[model samples]
Target: MTAFQPDLSSALAGSACLGAWAHDPASDRIALSPVLARLLAVPAEAATGTSLTLALAAVEAEDAVRVAGVLRAAGEDGRPFEAEFRTRPGPDGARWLRLMGRCGRDPATGAVTTQGLAFDLTEGRRPVGSDAQQAQRQVNRLADHAAAMKGLVAGLRNPPLARLVDEVAVEVGHELARHLRGGGRQVH
Candidate 1:
C-alpha cells in the first residue's frame, strides 16, 4: 500500500487565520506562507523572497524593537521564542498576531533557521473597555495552549497523529478566537 500524502496547499488554503514562516539567520531572509503574507500586509509574491527587515516592517512601531530583540536573542541562543505584536493598519486595519517558533540548524546546509507559526489574534480582540482586559487574558491563554500543544506534538513519534493533533489545536484556536471576537455570544 502506498503511504498517505496530504496536499499541503489545500491544507494551507483552508487555514485562513493561521500562517507559517521561516527565517534564515545567515541571509537575514524570510519566507512567509501566503496566509502569513496576507496577515502581515505583505504581498504574497513578495513574501517568498522578502528580507527579514522587510517582513518586520509591518510590525507596529511600538512593538518593533521588542520583537526584534526577541528574535535576535532566539537566534543567538537557538531557543524557542514567543511574541505578540500588532501590525500597522492596512486594508484590513490593524491586526494582532502571536508568533511562536524555535531556532535550529539545518542539517544539510548547516545553516541556522527560525521557523514558526503566526496566529491572527485580531478577530478575538474586544474593543477598549472593561471587557478588553478579560479578552486579552483569554487570548493569552489560547496562545499558551497552542504553544504547549506544539511542544507536545514535537514529542510524538507518529507523524500522522502529530499532524492531526496540530490541526485540531489550530481549529479549536480559530473557533475560540471567533467566539471572543463575537463578544462571547452563543452562536445558536
Candidate 2:
C-alpha cells in the first residue's frame, strides 16, 4: 500500500509538534511518519509496518482504551474522530497529543483506511514529578511491556501464535491497570 503523507506544513504552519499517520484495516497495519513515530516512542524502523495495537501501546494506560475505541468507531462508520490523550511517561515525562482523522476508501483497492495527524499539546509545559506522576510511571512500565510484546507479535508468521501473544499482552495490560486502580489514589 502507498504511504499516506498528508500536507502538514500549511496545517501546522511550521509547528514542530505535528505528525501524520494512516491506518489500513484490511491489513491491520498502521503507517506513522518519522516525526510521529518518535513522538509515540516507536522505533523508526518499525513505524511504517506497525499495527494499531502497537501504536496505541505508547499511549498512557488511562487513555489507551478510549483512544482505541474512538479510532475503531471511526474506522467502522467512516466518520471523523478527534481525541486528546497523554503519552506514557518518558524522558520528557508524559505529554499530551491530539489525534484527528477520518475514514475513506482507497480508490484503487476500495480498502477502508483512516488518515490523520497528531499534534503535540505539551510544547510549552515543563515536565515535573509528583506522586501522581510516579504512579503513572509505574503504569507506563506496563505499557512498555505491552509494546514489546506487540513487536514480537508483529514478527510471528503463524496466525495462532500472533493472536496468542496479542491476547497475553492485552490481558497483562488490563491486569496491571486493575492493580493500579486498586490503589487508593487516582490521577486525572
Candidate 3:
C-alpha cells in the first residue's frame, strides 16, 4: 500500500468526508480508502487484505447484529441496501454512519461487489433516533391521559360535588402532563 490519498477522485465527488471500497467481485478482495478505514477505525494497511466479514466483526455487537440481515441479502441475492448504524470510533466517543449502496455485478468480472459511501454523522443523527423515542413516549402518555380522563368523567357524574371537583382536578393534571409530553400542544 503506497502513500496514496485513497484515489477517490471520481467516486467521492460532492461527498462529505467519506470512504469508498471497490472490490474484485470474484475474489471478494476489497480496495478501501482511508476515509472509510478511519470511519471503521481499521488500519489502512490491514484493511486492504481483510475480508468484509472480518471487518464487520469489529463493529459493535449490537449494530453488527442489526446489519447482518442486510449483509446476507446483499451477498446471496445482490440485493440493494441502505442502513444507518452506530459504531464506537475508539476511546474518544461514538459516531453514527449512514451507508447507502448495493451489491451488483462488477463491470470487470460480472461478479457482485458491495460498494457504497460511508460518512460519519457526529451531530446529524442524534435528533432522528431521539425524535422517534420521544414520539413513542408521547403516544404512551396520551394513552394514559385518555384512561385517566375516562375515570374522571365517570367520577364527576356520580353526585358528590366534593368528589367531582377532586376528580376534575386529577383529570386536568393528567391532561397537562400529556400536553407537555406532546410538545406542549394544547389539546382540547
Candidate 4:
C-alpha cells in the first residue's frame, strides 16, 4: 500500500489556533490558555479569577450583547455555540475573535461550566491552498528577515522600524501555528 500523506497546504489553510478555556460560575474560577490571555491583553495569571469578564471586555460594545446572549443560551440549554465578533480596541484596530464552546454540568459538584476554544479571526482569512503554502514559505523566509531586520535596526537606530518587523514576525508565527493546530471540526 502507498504511504498516506496529508496535504500540508490545505490542512494549514483550513486550520485554526484553538485556545481552550473552562469557566466555573459557582466558584467564579476560570482556566485559560496563554494564547487566550495574550489575545485579550490580560496577564496570564490574572485570567484565572475573572476570565469571562476579560474575554467579554475584548468584544466590541455593539456585539457584546449578542455574543453574551449566545453564550448565555448555551449555558442554560447545554448546547454548543460558535460566534465571530469584533473586539473593541481602536478605530483602526481589527480585533476579531471567534469563540466555539459548550456548557456542561459536573456530576459530582453539580456546577455548570462552559468550555471551548477561541480563535483569533482578526485577519478575516480563509486562506486559499496556494496562499497557505506561500504563507508557510514566507514564515521560513522571515527567519532570515528577522535577523536582518534586527541588524539593520541596530545600525540605523530606528526603533519604529524594529517594532514593525517584530510585529510582523510575531503575526506570521502565530498564524502559522494556529493554522496547524485548528484541524478538527467545530465542537459539538
* lDDT by residue (tens digit), candidate 2, 69-141: 7777878999887888999887767888888999998899888998898777776344468766655666676
Alpha carbon RMSD to native, model 3: 14.8
lDDT: worst 10-residue window of model 3: 8-17
Could you give the candidate ranking by TM-score, starting with the highest? Answer: 1, 2, 3, 4
Instruction: Give the C-alpha miss distance for residue 155 in model 1, angstroms.
Output: 26
Ranking by lDDT: 1, 2, 4, 3
**Candidate 4 — worst ten consecutive residues by lDDT sum?**
179-188
TM-scores, all models, native as reference: 0.60, 0.58, 0.54, 0.53
Residue pair clashes in candidate 1? none
lDDT of each: 0.77, 0.77, 0.62, 0.68
Best by TM-score: 1
- Candidate 4 regions off by >4 Å? 1-14, 27-30, 90-92, 126-188
lDDT of model 2, residue 76: 91
Candidate 1 residue lDDT tens string, 1-188: 12477676676455433777888776777888787787676777888878777788888886977877777777889989899899998888888888889999989988898888877878667466566667656766777777777787887688997888788677757756765676565333
How many steric clashes does model 3 contain? 0
Runs of candidate 1 with Cα error greater than 4 angstroms are: 1-17, 127-188
